[model samples]
Each structure stands twice: as structure tokens, then as C-alpha cells.
Target: MSDATTSDPGTRARPVDVSERVALLDVLRGFALWGVFVSNSFAWFSGYVLLPRAQAQALSAPGLEAVVSGLYHFFVNQKFITLFSFLFGLGFSIQLARAEARKSSIVPLYSRRLGVLLAIGLVHLVAVWAGDILSTYAVLGFMLLLFRQRSDRTVLTWAGGLLVAVPLLAPFVQHYGPILLHGAQAAAQAAKASNEIDLRAKEQLLAGLSSDSFWTAQAANARFLTHMVPQSKRLLWMASILGRFLLGLLAGRYLLLQEVERRRSWHHRLLFWGLVLGVLGNGAGVVMQRLRLAGLVDPARDPWMLAMSAVMEVGFLGLAAAYVAAFALLFQRERWRRVMQVLAPVGRMALTNYLLQSVVSLCLYDGWGLGLIGKLPPSRCVALTLIIFALQVPFSHAWLSRFRFGPAEWLWRSLTYGRRQPMRLAPGDAPASMTG
Candidate 1:
């Protein structure tokens, strides 16, 4: 497929054709989905996050689960999500470029697109799972429009500032905000009261999720979404996500992935530095986590907390960047490229597959289904994740062969354009031939 930009100023803005996609981006998206699935399954879907701290720790298997847990913290946790966010930003940049090439206004079409995405995200969040990132992404996506006309340097600066400031500022805010609002004595009392309430809420959530009725589970999910999760924390987290998006935008503006060979040396540099920083940052994070778990360190304390904050803030970016660089370099080779391209189909239908993962896992773990919540150990969760993803690989291939878009993608497009999209591939279209 040619890497040519699709332009249709004479017509309404529609989805890009299969042939116009950059295959590597699709491949990367597919790859990221696996890690995202693994992370979500192990952390959220398994009901591990809702368990009491002691009970959760007790469920960890000694030998292999320890290793699996370590590997997940070091490599899997936030890294793929970071990559996914970058891809979203990169995709936006591509769309903006397409609009410019076509000499058309991007506002109307792009706004509709984001609006549709936001609607989908809200539905997914309320009905499906509380761990949904789509709603957050859809909301933050609107902010991307503000930077569309900004200079590259300005974009880079804001991205860097937000990325750095969020971590540094979060610690200070969490530690001091209550004290500033109330007195120190009152703040301590509030903290104690808040912790107690949170515990009770989580226990209730656990009960709701473990109940046999779907309505019960849904009510619990709704309560958690609306009241349990703190808004201030969510906003801080959004800043980091926006930072990553800006970074992706910068990359897209330069068409870095589009001309990988020409920027080979730059990729090499990114690979080297990214690996160095990823190891240092994520490695420190692993150690800090272990110490906290061991009760040797308190993340609520001063310098240790600061260090931990910094690591948590920027650690994922280094590794995610390394993955992108490494993937690009390997994709330059025929042999490696062939193997990685297997993920392209999955990536092409990423939205469908992502939502599918939530649905499938809820059935396997939630009360209304198999009710395996809090039962599976970390090792088994990892195993289940792999098994499910293994099935999805072929399923994506089969589905994409006969269809123009995944079901979710088709719906999104149809809604955005106010018309039903062509689902079945045209007579002459290749079964497996399409771009993201």
C-alpha cells in the first residue's frame, strides 16, 4: 500500500481507504492492544484492584507469579497505554494533514468524529467497565484541536512541561491541598475518615461485582465511576495523557514514521537513549514498588515519595519510545517485518477488539457470567490474557477479510458521517488488503 495521503475536498470527509494507511502504525496499534489487554485483565478485570490490600497480596503465587508481577510492573503496566495515546495523537496529526492536503476545513468533520468517539466512550464506560480509557481519551482529544495551529516548537515545549510538571506537582498537591484548605489537624482527621469510607466503598463494590445479578454489578460499577474515583486525581492523570498526545502530534507533524528509513539514524539514537532511560526510570520504579511492598519505604513520605513520583511520571515514556524505535528499526527488515505484520489486522480493528476484550473478560470474571472474580492468580490471569488474545489474532484476520471495518469502527464512521458505511468489501477489494 502506498503511503500517499487521501484528499477529497470535493466530497465530505470520510474514513481513509485501506491502501492509504501506514502499515507500521496499524502494526504498532495491534501490538499495543495485546499489552493493554494483559494489563487490564491482570489488574482490573481480575478484581485484584478491589481486594483488600492484605488479601490481594495473599493471592499472589510465590514463585512464578512473583516474576510475572515484576515483569508486568517493569514492562507492561503503563507502557502500552502510553504507546496507545501516542498513536491517537499521531492519527490526529495525520488527519489534520489530510485536511490540509484536501484544502478543506477540519473542524466540522473532526469534531463530529470526536463527538462520536466520546459517545461510544461514555456508553462503554457506563455499561461495560469502569476501567475504560476511551471516555478520557475522547474528552482530552478535543484539546488537541487547540494545538493544531500551534508551532512545532510550541507543541513540543507544552508537551515537555506538562509531562514534567504533572508528576512533580501531583505529590505536592496531594500532600498539601487538604492542609491548605483546612487546618493540619482537620486534614489528618479528614484523611482518616476518607480512607475508611473508601475501604467501605470498595468492599461494597466487591460485593456488587461478585453478586449473580447483572444489575447489581452495573449499579456498583456506576457508583464507583461517579463517586469513588477522585476528580482531582483524574485531572492530574489527564495532564500526563495530554502530554503524551502532544509528543505524538509532534512526531506526526514531522511524518517521522512515514519516512522511517530517512530518519534511521534518529531512530537509532532514540532506541539507545530510550532504552537507557527506560531501564533507569522503570528499574527504579520496580525497586521503589518492592520497597513499599516490603514496608521499607512510604510513598506518602517526602524524598522517597518525590523520587517515586518522578519515576511514575516519566518512566513509561522512555520504554514506550524505545518500543516504537525498536519496532521501526525491525520493520525496516523483511524478515522481522513479516512476523510483526501479523499484528496489522488486529490493529486495524483495534476499537472492536479492545471493547471485545472488556466484554469477554467480564463474562469470564464478573458475577453475571462465570464469576471468576478475585479467583484467578496473577499467573493464571496472564495465561488467560494470552489465550484470549491468541483467539483474537485469527478472529481479526477472518473478520477483516470480508469487511471494510470492524463493527465498532463501522458504527463510529457511520454516525460521524450521518450515513451507514459500506461494511462488506467491494467486489474487487482484496480480502486482507486495507490500511488503518
Candidate 2:
């Protein structure tokens, strides 16, 4: 996409117009949102992550449930979040291009946007869940501006480094950093002690989340967040997320979605490679995960754990890219386009739906709500996720029909622009469409 330059340099910064929206992006978001919910529900909301290895395994029945869990780990985990992070970066690119076109400064406007997102994320983290990604995105988003003016080769280089090289090196760092500092024996002892501490922490968190009082749960959530902040693992996660953002930014820079037809061959190649790499990477991951669960491989002690983790991480990106490519291809067909268009509204209102998923999931599983945490089977959690998303699709359509912006989106725009955005669509105005 050529830079958007304008004769008028004094034009005010504003949101992207409705007509300029990308329909495919929204559809992808909607699709990714469902996957996010599935992951959250199966792992976090169901309290599966908090369980000890033995207990978690006990919950997995030997036949259908085991198969479902294996399939999910192989294909679902990490893939959607990877896609979502890319979309974020892509959105940044879009904003940057718009700013260039208007001859307006992106810093002031973009910073304001990130600020609002950070505020929202903090609220979500403290008040709702510990898994909020918004604050992290906002923080790293500031760094993306540094790359805005960099050449495409430079951008791709940084992104590739973050995504591939970082993960490949992380395991060695995790294993060796402690030993180099404290010696092998001491490091092994420290690892054991750390494991104990982590177990106790999870137990405490489970207690809090399973408590009948809302304040108790909030306190537990806060404590968990506090514990997570200083950890090196969080840094790795942030790095991975930033890489996805850069990829998205790159996409936006080229107007990738807008030129899909012209780049059909490119997409096809991506689709093919994505499937091959995704399968190879995630297939290994599934085997490693199963071994870990069965107490056959310990990340702290095993020599092969490093390679396994790297494969999983790379596989995540591969699968996510494949999903995007496949979706793009299907969207080009008339019949598939009609079938998938229902997701567009949900995608447009992604922020609202994302937050809504947290609220609804908490209500269904947390102690203060149904108190079903740790009780639902993996299958049931998966089913509930589907049901929640099914409901969201129609809700998004109805809400969008009456309002121009989603509830959360309106708040974000209003806060960013320092004015209440127009919320109601004019009577004769066409509802939002992705025409870009």
C-alpha cells in the first residue's frame, strides 16, 4: 500500500471511516475470538491450569476426553492468540498509513489510543482476570512506533528475530542462566524449591477463585498478577506477542488484505507452508506435552525440553498463518463468503466480545457465580465455549444494527479523542461494511 499523503497537513486525526474498514480482518478477528475463548475456557476458566499434574490427568478420561484434549493442544492452543497479536500489529500499520496520508502526526493520536487501551487493560487485569493482554499490547505498542519509519527489510528482520531466534534461545537461557550464576547443584535445588513455591501459589489461587466472595476472588487474582509481573517467563511472552504485532504491522504497511486477489499466489504458498510446518511443529509438541503430563519429561531436567518448546512455539505461528491463508482463500468464494460473513459483526466488536467472554466465563465457573470451576470436564468446557460464541454472533449483529460503534469501542474512541464519538447511525446510513 502506497503511503497516504494529503495536500492538507492540518487535518485532524480521527478514527478510520466505516467504508474503509477491512471485512476480512473483522471476520478473522471474530474467528480468532472464538478460539481465544476455547483456550481460556479449557485452561484458565475451567481451573485446569491450577490443578496439580495428577489431578489434571485424572480429569481427562481415557477415551473421548483424552482425544479432545490432545487435539486441542495440537491445533488450538497458542494459535489464535498468535493470530490476534498479528491483527494488532496490522491495525497499527493501518493507523500509521492513515496518519502519513493525512500528513498528521501519529504519535499524539496513537499514544492516546494506546493510553486508553492500557487503562482498559489495567481495569480488566485487576477487576476481572489475570490473563488480560491489552496492557501488555499497549506497552509494547509504544515500541512499534520506533519501527514505523524503518525500511520493510528492517521490519521483517526484527520480527523474524523476535519470533524465531528468541524462542529457540529461551530454553538454553532458562536452563543455563541459573546454573551459570549459582552452579549446577545449587540450581537444581533452587528449581525444586521454586516448583514447590509455584505449587503452593496455584493452590492458594484456586482457593481464592473458588471462594464464594467476590472480593476474595479479586484479591487472589491481584496476588497472582503481582507474582507474575517480575517473572522472566512474562518477558518471553511479551517478546513473542511483540513479534506478532510486528508481523501485523508489516501486513498493514503493504495493505496485505486489500491486495489479497493480487497476491493470491503468495497466500497459497503461505497456506501450504503453514500447514506443513504447523503439523510438524505441533505434532512434536503434542508428544512432548503428553510425556510431560505423564511425568516422563521434566522441563527443568530434560535435555530435549528446549527443542520441544521451540518447536511448539514455531508451530503456533505456522498454524495461525495457515488459518489466515485458508480463511482468505475461502472468503474469495461466493458461497463461503456468505456463510462466513456472520462473523464480521463479531469481529467489528471484538473488544466488547473479548471482555464479555471473560465476564460470562467467570460467571459460569468462578466461585462467586456458578462455582463450577474444577468441576466441569474438558468436554463440557469446550461445549460451553461454543455456546457462548454462538450467542455472541447474534448479539453483535443486533447491537451493531442499532449503534455505530460497539460499547467498548465507543468508550475507547471517546476517551482517545477527548470527545464522545457519534454512537447512533443515521437512519439512511448503511450499516458498517468492510470495503477497504
Candidate 3:
């Protein structure tokens, strides 16, 4: 009910030119990456990998860890991921425009791009980490192609329909949750009944991701992914991501970003209402989860969980929109603009950073690297996240100052276009697509 958008005539001239981008989008994306890094850090460093996969979220916490988890649940959980999905959708719109502008084929190019993304994500999931979303994004991206030529209302309707359907249909879906949960629980119990393993040692090695031998952690990861990846590919996950993509499409289709000044009034309204609705919505979801955790609500009660989750889902959508609007509005000012521009490079090289973040975090936390998984409390994880991203800020700038694309991004673009792209920044260098 709180959604609002405005299109301005003055800003409707040309589509988003990649060489000359709306710096605001880059800045927003860069900022969102940080949020994502922090959110994932909470999981990795705060004991996500330590527990049995099903029971990770079920672990109890006290004091600062609880506070941190609660805050992340309300303010972060879907907010940043929503932003990521939205940007993906927006990038698609831009890609479509660019191809059309150049009289090029859209499907073949886009398909190749998504294919490469899926490949990279698969490797990342199997070898480095199991929390990869790229493969799923690649899969859902194909679905987006079906809606591309549709009218704005059609796109919105499909997106909204999916969003609303997730919570409503979840009651039906949870018929599987209990059965699956039970099976997984039994399997876990059976696995734990091992003769050749030490419980404490196994838990420590797996939890800390520490490795006394090569491929040991990786073997554990493979086992985890066998269970985990399928769980992530569930309908709710895809629907939520797809819904945000549709919203991003709407923003891109209207070119609403082109006229930030003209749209200030709407941006202000979105900011005010977005925060109000977003907080309450996400908060309801968090409370619902907490209740379920505390045994106040039955885990098998799909209807109640679905209903509350719907509220939470809607709230996340609203809040994500509000963030975009808030950032868009701020881009028109100077007080925070200069500072925020620092992330522009990071966003510009988002792909490289995304993969870099996973590799770096795994090396720092996983048993394979520093093995400091359970050791880092929320407070220290928070600090570590800041340190990681702080280093990335300057690193991104320095890299972009000379190169046209980040290493991964460059490879992706080259494969996407079926040609070598100019990696070095030159006077005539002008990007034709959103490389990331």
C-alpha cells in the first residue's frame, strides 16, 4: 500500500548509458555490498558453519550476540539482498536498452552471461563456500527474460503476485518442511553415530573449518552443500529475489533515477513510510522466528508461520525501497555524497568484490585458513567486517583507477561478449554494459 514512484519528462530522454552511469546506483550498490558482507559475516563468524546445518539458526545466544542477531534480523536480513536483486534487475533493463540501442541480439548475449554466472557460482559453492546466490540468480534471471517485453503493470503484477503467493502458499509447502526436517534430523543423528570419528574433534574441525589435512574441510563442505544448496533454491528464496528484481525493473523502466530532483518529493515520502513499514514488517518476522525458537509457536504450524512471514516479506520489500529512495535523495546533496562515492568503485567492480569477499571470509574464518569461526563473537565479527570492507574501499579505487574492470568482471565480460574486453582504463575506454 505504501509503494510510490514518479517519472519526470526531463529525465526521459536517453536510457542509462554505461560509460556515463548514474553514479548514485554504483554508490548504492557498493554500500549494499557492505551490508551483505556484514550479514554473512554474522553467520560465518558467529557459528553458522559450526552447528548441524538445520540447527544453526536454532542456536541460543546471550547479550551482545543476541542483540546483534536481533538487529541484523530487523534491519539487514532481506534489506541488502533485496538491494542486490533489485540491482540485478536494473542491470538487466540497462542491458536490454543497450542491445536495442545497438541493434544487437539480447537473448543470446544475456543467456551466455547468465550461463557464465551460474558456472562461477557453482565453483564458488562447491570449492569455496556454500552460501553462493549467483547460481540461483542465474537461474531466476532466465525467468526474468519472459517478463522483459511485458508492460510495466504486467511486470508489477507478476512480481507482486509471486511476493504475495510465497507467504500464502507456504502453508502448503511446509507439508514438506516437517517431513524434510525429520529426515534431515534422522540423517544427522545417523551420521553422528560414527565409530571412526571423535565427536569433539569432528565438531571442532568442521565448526572451526580448521584443517589438519588437505580436502578435509572441502569434504565437509561438499557434504554440507549436498544438503544446503537445495534448501537455498527453495521457492520462497527464488520468489523473494525475483520479486525485488521486478521492482528494480519498474524503476529502470520508468527511468525514475534520471530525475532525482524532480522525484525528491516522492523519495521523501518513500523514505518516511518505508522505514516505518519496513521496521514493523521485518520486526514481525523476527519476533515470529524468535517465538518459534522459544517453543511458543509450533515449528510445524505452517499457517501461522506463513502468515507472519508474509508480513515480514512485505516489510522487507518496503524497507528496501525506502533505502533506495533515501539514497537517491541523498545523492542530490554534498554533505554525504563525497564520502559515499568511495564505494562507487566497489560497486563498479561488484562481481570481483563479491567473489573476493567469499574467498577472503573463508580464508579468515573457515578452518582452512585462520580457523577463527566460533572464536569471533558478534562484536569482533562486526569489527572484522569493517576492516575487510575498509580495505576494499581503497583497493577498489586503486584498481579502477587503472583498469576498466575487475579481474572477474573482465573475464565475465569477455566471455559474455565473446571477445577480449579492454581491461586497462584508457582515454577512449567506454563500457557498453554493466560489467558486473
Q: Give the Cα lDDT of each candidate.
A: 0.85, 0.85, 0.72
Q: What ranges in model 2 sit over 4 Å off?
A: 1-10, 433-436
Clash totals for all candidate models: 1, 5, 2
Q: TM-scores, in order shown? A: 0.96, 0.96, 0.83
For TM-score, candidate 1 versus 3, the one ahead is: 1
C-alpha lDDT (0 to 100) for residue 178 of candidate 2? 92
RMSD of each: 2.3, 2.5, 6.5
**Poorest 10 consecutive residues of model 2 by lDDT?**
1-10
lDDT of 1 by residue, 374-406 (tens): 988899999999999999999999998999789
Lowest summed lDDT across 10 adjacent residues in model 3 is found at 1-10
lDDT of 1 at 241: 89
lDDT of 3 by residue, 190-215 (tens): 44553124344336446426664437
Which regions of candidate 1 fall more than 4 Å away from where they truly are?
1-5, 433-436
Alpha carbon lDDT at 430, candidate 2:
65
Better of 2 and 3 by TM-score: 2
